[model samples]
Structure formats: structure tokens, C-alpha cells
Target: MTAKFASLSCAAIIVAATHAFHPSALPSSSRRPATTTTTTTRLPMSFMADSSDYKADKSDFGDGADEDPDAAPAPLRGEVDMADVPVTEEIPVPMSRNNVGNRFLAVVLDGSFNKDDAKDAWEMHGDRIALTERHVMWARKQNLYNETFNLESRADVLWSHQLLSSDLQRAVGHAMCIDSPTIEDCREAISRDPIVRSLLGVDPETGMCDVSPVPLYRWRQIRDHTLRIDDGRDGLPNMVMAFDRPEAISDGLREEVSNDHLEYLIRSERVIAAGPLHVATPDKTDPRSIAIGTLLFFNAVDREDAIEFVENDPAARAGLYETMTVHRFNSLDVTGKFVSENLYFPGQNTYQMKEAMEHWGYPVDDLQTKWLNW
Candidate 1:
């Protein structure tokens, strides 16, 4: 399949008749002609060519003559000189969760970025679709997976609203793929990216940015899409999981917080509601009188006394309730109650919540802990 050719030099002026042979019509042996000549002076034996030389030249005929045996011959109108062409290699496009195969469902949980809850949710529901964060720094620190998580604040939605550009919002989601060490680390890393800071209009020197208030209706839409939950029994749609910002809850705002708020909090306690059990339907002596059970969390000083009252109360003694689940942690941070003087205003929180709200562009004036009442 391979051939080599060598150069020859001759000084004697001896010529022989040359004939071109049609490669297909001639036999292999006859394809190459034997060269013979008579000379007047004695010539060196080197002048007599060897059959090996001829064979080498014949083997290399196609290449030396600029012909390709493997390529199809062109039309008789013209002869085409064939040359080897080098092939080019293709670059690959990066794979992302959005473009991966469609065996998995993509769920965007609209909630506060609780690292532990996010991990648990992924384990529970992230079948094949890679889970990523909107937080760029978190992505880098965790270096946990090959995917990027988007951590764009409500600002993305606000921008979308102002500009009416779905494409811009989607692009922001796409750009969140940077790697990070941990969730906190990722936020820090993202904060350092100049492009991100510019897009969010964050000032590096002052650590401040101006953001627009999230339209209430739009926020609700985003929340619904992200926090879908499936209760584990009877295939009934009973509950949806979400990260609730106590600040966003408004009192008497039926449009925002429906009666379902109480139901959601109760369900969050992991209690099952009973059907049609009543304590008020009492005929004091009627055997049909039934008791009702309810769960409560108390932060009272006399805990034992409070429990006793519940146990001895007619409603409590009626077997309407079974037990109380109590959790006592160091009560730090603001509780959801409005103080008369409004000391715990919106802008007066610790770094985490304040920074988060500021990033989202919410007004910080006169905001009370009552704003968080659920």
C-alpha cells in the first residue's frame, strides 16, 4: 500500500523511445518497460539501472505523477490533479441540565436558599436532571457537581418586568453555571465576578445595589412553579412545599395569604387533621358529644402550668387532643410580632435577611416584625 522513490543522475547522452502504458490494459510485468542502450565509450556499471529501481519508480507512479488510484477519475474533458486533504476536528459544545436528555422532570423550587433543604429536595426529587443553584459562589465552593446553580435574586424577575424580555431572564439563568466551594462560598465568589456585579448593578466599593420591588402577582407565579410538593399517601394533592418569607406575609391581605396559611403551618407541623370531630356540639350528658384535638407551640414561662391547663380544660379533657410536640431552641432573631413602636423595622435585621431583602429591592422603611406573621 506504501511506496518509496529515489532520485537518479545521468551524464551520458543516450535516449530511448518512451511509451505510456494504459494501466488497466497492460499486465503488471509489462506495465514497466526495460531500459537498454548501446554506448560508444565504456560506461560505469552504475549506469546500468537495477530492476529494484524500476520497481520502486513504478510503485510510486501515482504519487510522483500527481495521480490518485483510490479517487474516482474525472471526466475526459480535463485531468484533475489529486492531492491529500487534511481533515478538520470538531469542537464540542458543553452539556447543561437544560439540554440533557428528557427522562427527568425539572422542578424549580421558589424558596429561600436553605442549603440543607435544597440537598434533601434533590435527593428526594432530582431524578436525573442535575440540580444547580442560582448562587454562583455556592456553585464554585461546592464544586460538588458538574452543573451550575442559578442564584439570581428577584431582580431578574424585576428586570424582566421592566424590559419585557423573557430572553434576558433566561440568559441570567444560563449564566449561573460558575463553580463554587460551598453555598456561602458560592455567594461570595459570585459577588466577586465583575460581570455579575455589573449586571446586578452592585457597587463593589459600597456593597450596595438598587433593585426594584417584586410585583406581588409575579412573585406568586414564580413561587407556584418552583415549590410543588407531593404528599406521600393516597395520591391526593394535599400540600405544596415552599420557602416562606415571614416578611412577605401581610395581615388582612386575603389576596396574598389565604386561609390556607393556617393550614400550611399546621401541616408543616406534620400533623394529620381529623374529620368532623366537634367539642361544641355538646349536650352535656349526650354520649354523642365528641372532643377535638389540636397541636400548639408555646413559648410561655410556666410551661408545666400551661400544659396542665390544656389537660384539665373541658375541651382538652374531652379526649379531643392526643399530645403536643414541643421544640425549644435558643430563641434568637426576631419573632413574628408587630411592636407598637416599630423598632424591628425592615432594614434593621441581621446581615443575612437584610442583605437578601436589599438585594431584592424591597423598601426598608417602617417594616415591622409583624410583616412576617404567617
Candidate 2:
């Protein structure tokens, strides 16, 4: 049931915790500035919980070891008025992935935004979440009747339906993937997504949205130990996804050195998912589709570590890519679910693709010529 507010003035305003700098946010001629970064700090505020209710326990402060007699006595905890306190109402945390199906998933987006529009795109959270929840319900129903194909090949599944927050000017740093039954079904659902249509500008002539499906291939589980520790805070991005678009004429160099880059990632043992992002094709079997770029999701000590990891790759060293954009990523899953073990992609490991290929009846030789050659 939808909750109806008495009036728009009484409705709670939504706040974002992070921003993103998407490469697509800039025009081709105007290049994005490069800079190293750590995770942004999460302000202590939320609409879901009231910190104003916090009670002070003098015992918890350990009796001020070096008390300053000259300092004025601190104000009583309960003395301050609530209206006098400043607070930033940030969005509440989304559901955790632990309780949901551990199987890998995908999300496809159909929309367009210009470079100048990035500033205004980040607004609107209440309406976006409402629309997003409705889309998730519709996707779950579609999965029930979907009989053709499911990437997970499971009897029951929960699809992820969440919007990404950007810390930079870009509203959407990267596209997500949905585990729909078929490519066509996924595209149809995205077209009807109210949030996507409303947030993105449409082409005047074509009157259509630009569609792109990012199929995330999880190579291993998230290694929290390998990630850089922040100020012991919650709500920080635990992983990073770097999207690299190869130069128009560097296909030969990319293909020649792709294997080396894969080998480097496998050796590091921190790769969570890595694969190509392509233009939406008619179907998976279509032979006419061409490659547009590649995506790398991995664990790193910090943003700098991630940048160096991708920059040192054979493809990057060889100048095969025209641009690479790295953004902190957090996968939003179903809420109320918690698990101890963090298994990103179950029953598969990039380190042992040889055995996985043989187990699935795929030609092992193609692992070198085709799989790693992306």
C-alpha cells in the first residue's frame, strides 16, 4: 500500500550521501579531470532513525582524565532544544545482499543526459525510491512467468532494483544489470521504468532513450580484508568499478594484450568482477554486435590503489583505451537479510576458469582465444 501524506509540505525531504563523476557526464571535447580520492565521509544523520534521542552516560566518557578547571561546565545533554540542533537528513541504508540469493545479477538502463544536465540530475529521492520499488515488484512478477532463460538458472530469485548515487556531477556513474528472463524482456521493463524515464532526457527526433545493458560477471567474492579501512564507518563503498573505453582503432592492441591484463588480475586475487560492456544487441547469439568497452570491479586499499591496478594493466600501458573512469561502487540488495560469508558469485572463480569451462561443456581452448581476449 502506498503511504499518502496529508500534504506535500508535510512530506519528508530526501538527502543523498554520495556523489559521482561519471566520464559520460562530459562532452567528448571536454575531458574529465583526473584526481585520486578516498571514500567520502558519511554525515551522521538519517530519516529512519533519530539521533536526537541519544542519552548521555557520563560513565562512558571515562571521567575526563585531563579535565580543564578553567573551561566552563558542559551543557546538560537533555537541556538543548531539538529545534536548535542542526541535522542533515540522509537516505537510509538499502538492504544487504547477505539474505538474498547469492547468485550473480545484472541491470540495464535506458536513458540519456547531457553534460550540462549533470548538476540538476542528482535531485529527487522520495519519488525515485517509490518508482523504484514499484519497478522491483513488477520485475519479480515477470521472473515468475519467465521461462526462456535466467542467468542464475534457479527456481526462485529476487531482483535488485536500486538507484545509484553520484558524488560528482554525473547522476549515474555506471549502468546496472537485471536478471530478467531474456534480453528483450529486460529492455522492455527498463523502458517502462518511471524513474528512468522521468530522470533522463529523451531525444527530440527519435523520442527514445539510449539503452545499455551491463552484465556483471562476478569472478570472486568480496575480500573485505583486502579493501582499505576507512575511519571505522558504515555506508562507505566497499568495492570499486572502473569502466575503460578502448580507443576506436586500438582493437588489435586490446585483443593482443587482454590476456596479460586478465593474468595480472588473477594473480592479485582481488578481482570481484571483470568483463566487457557492449552495445545492446538483438540477442546473445547475434554475431554483428561490436565491443564498446570493458568494466573492472575489484577490491583495493583505496581509490589510488584501484587506479594504479587498472592503469598498470597491459592494455592501459599500451594506450589501447581512450578513457577510464573509476567510481566507488556499492551493490544494493534486499533488506532484512544478513550473512557472514560474502560470496559475490557462487560456484565460480576466475582463478579456475579452466575447470569451470570444462564443467559447462565450453571449449577450453576458447578460454584463451575468446574469454580472456575481451
Best by TM-score: 2
Could you give the C-alpha RMSD of every candidate to the true structure, in order shown?
Answer: 39.9, 20.0
Per-residue lDDT of candidate 1, residues 12-120 (tens digit): 1111111100010001121112223345653233322654532333432354567666886454433323233334443232233222211110111211122334433
**Clash counts for all predictions:** 26, 12
- The TM-score of predicted model 1 comes to 0.17
Model 1 ranges with Cα > 4 A deviation: 1-292, 295-299, 329-357, 360-374
Q: Estimate TM-scores for all models.
A: 0.17, 0.45
Worst 10 residues of 1 by lDDT: 156-165
